[model samples]
Target: MSLELDINAAIKAAMLGKKEAELRALRAIKAAILLAKTAEGGNGELTEADESKLLQKLAKQRKDSLEIFRQQNREDLAVKEEEELAIIEQFLPQQMSEAELRTALTGIIAEVGASSPADMGKVMGVATKQLAGKTDGKAISAMVKELLK
Candidate 1:
């Protein structure tokens, strides 16, 4: 519940500071968490992995919206999505740099003996597990394809 505590603290601070944009993002996060907690089959306590996955999902949603908004010339909407994304990503682990991702994926490839695109599944399964919360899946996929080729 540390995430919840931190979020609540942030909500209070945001309320004090009267930052409307940030307050909106923080409330959205709190709502998502509460909904997750009460959803059917929810176990009430989310593990660190669960928290990371949830944050990643939220970030992904914002990114996708941001991309679409940009494409459609909806800068008005894109700005809000970008702001929300920034706030959501703040709670996630630091992303691996491209160089760092390459190094890590290279090591995983060797460990799994994945030498061709055919072995992408094997490498991805391991990489996704090992690199959870550190990087997005699409980035990992692109790098894996590059390294394999």
Candidate 2:
């Protein structure tokens, strides 16, 4: 099913079950969808790639907030962000483990002829496109740097 449809169904289920945390996450997703549809250059709809990017962005935002809340010793707020992040993650593609990511990046570096750190830009361009839904940019960058060193 499409991301929008899946989110709407989840929203309905959350509402029926009176799941406040789940409902909050679902509503946030719905809002993000609407905003994406209306954004400049958006044709009032989202492609699969766009949907995946949106979900990743939301998950990352929640994670960042969770970190900040935890750092400030705000367990209550951190718990809420953690719940939302988990919910958002459920809709994302499975993240690659460190071993898997490293192996894949090795292949990518070779394919791109990235022999040194100077080739990071070239390698990152291809790696980000290939690894999009499977991993985030930070992990990709870190792995690429380590491999190139």
Candidate 3:
């Protein structure tokens, strides 16, 4: 099933169950889908790739918020952000574990002939495309830096 449809179903379920946090997260996703559909230059349809990108963006925002809230010692806000992040993550593809990511990045490094940090741009160009939905960009970059060092 398409992510949009799944999100709509989840919204309905959340509403029926009176799950406020889940309902909030699902509504945010629904709003994003609507915006994407009507956005200039958009094709009025949500492809699987587009959905994945949208979900990743939302997840990243929530994660950033969570981190900031934690740093500021705002437990209340951080908890909300954490809950939203978890909800958003459910729509994303399974993330690659560190070991798995390392293995993949090692192969990519070889394929791109990236031998040192200087080759980061070359490796990143390919890695971003290859691992887009499978892992977070920050994690990928960190692992790439570690592996290339």
Give me the candidate number with maximum TM-score.
3
Question: Comparing 1 and 2 by TM-score, which wins?
Answer: 1
List the candidate 2 regions with Cα displacement exceeding 4 Å: none
The list of candidate 3 runs beyond 4 A from truth reads none
The clash number for model 3 is 0
Q: Is candidate 1 or candidate 3 better by TM-score?
A: 3
**TM match of model 1 to true structure:** 0.95
The count of residue-pair clashes in candidate 1 stands at 0
Residues 1-149, model 3: lDDT tens digits: 88888998999999999999999899999999999999999889988889999999999999888889999999999988888888999889999999999999999999999898999999999999999889999999899899989
Q: lDDT scores for all predictions?
A: 0.92, 0.94, 0.92
Query: What tens-digit string does per-residue lDDT give for candidate 2 at 1-149?
Result: 89999999999999999999999998999999999999998799899889999999999999899999999999999999999988999998889999999999999998989999999999999999999988989999999999999
Estimate the overall C-alpha local distance difference test score of candidate 3: 0.92
- Ranked by lDDT, the better of candidates 2 and 3 is 2
Candidate 1 backbone collisions, by pair: none
Global Cα lDDT for candidate 1: 0.92
Candidate 1: tens digits of C-alpha lDDT, residues 1-149: 48889899999998999978788888988888898888899988777778788889999999999999999999999999999999998888789999999999999999999999999999999999999999999999999999999
